[model samples]
Target: MTWKRLVAIAIVIAVGFVGTILAGGLLPSGLASAQQEHREHGAPSSAPAAGAPTIAAVAVDFKFTPPEIRIKAGQTVNLVLTNRGAILHDLIIPGLKFHAAAEPGKKGTASLTAAKPGTYEFYCSVPGHREAGMKGRLIVTR
Candidate 1:
């Protein structure tokens, strides 16, 4: 094959490899990590409404103490999140715009105003924490 043809084939192969990596998301090209970062830190959206009341939540090693909570509507609530685990964890409820951070063997507390009555999801934003059942629920009532 001519030298020009060989060079063209090499360039095509290089482009194909780059495209494959981009499509497969095997590289951290910033764009590919956008969604992953959001997913990792986007825990609050899983919460219920924001107009309910105050409720307390606690976090522990791979678990959330008082995994279930109940509260009233229109009443300000306080969530006492205490991280008893050996790693960092965060309590996020985007729907309520509530976020709390806890460190290993340390206690953390966060508060949120509940504007509606419903059940909200609570989980640890730490890697693999939620998947390990490090989660709970915020139940609001009127």
Candidate 2:
């Protein structure tokens, strides 16, 4: 290749690398800010020191059985998710950054601590699942 073409390619690659590094740097700071915000406004009321409460649910064709769950604030919960359908399913609680997946005829469990008293939504992250009603409410009480 000609020197001019080589130089141009190198410049493009350098710029791309620099941009990637700069973008990566911003993410950690943004994550730290988000963690701080979660602590300030949405932190758990208390930590579970003993055995956690268990909640069980089954995933059947396009839906989650027992569409709602209730728990107390500061309680840690063991969520038992069973997929009894022909397809795969997973539970995702975005507010808590929790996810657990199970294939057909399988089971998955996730341990989560309840945050402040409020209603949070949990759903299957698989595309089109939520729209099809594979979702439910998680209510945390004081």
| Local accuracy of candidate 1 as per-residue lDDT tens digits, 19-131 | 99877785555545544653665443223345534445567768877888777777665565666767677887656777777677775655567789999997776656677
Off by over 4 Å in 1: 1-56
Which candidate number maximizes TM-score?
Answer: 2
Candidate 2 lDDT, tens digit per residue, 1-142?
Answer: 9999999999999999999999999988866764553344332223323577778989988888889988899888888889998987887777877676778999877787767999999887665677789899988899
Q: Pairing residues by index, what is the TM-score of model 1?
A: 0.61
**lDDT to native, each model:** 0.69, 0.78
Candidate 2 yields a Cα-based lDDT of 0.78
Clashing pairs in 2: none
What value does the lDDT take at residue 54 in candidate 2? Answer: 72
- The best candidate in terms of lDDT: 2
Give residue 19's lDDT in candidate 1 (0 to 100): 94
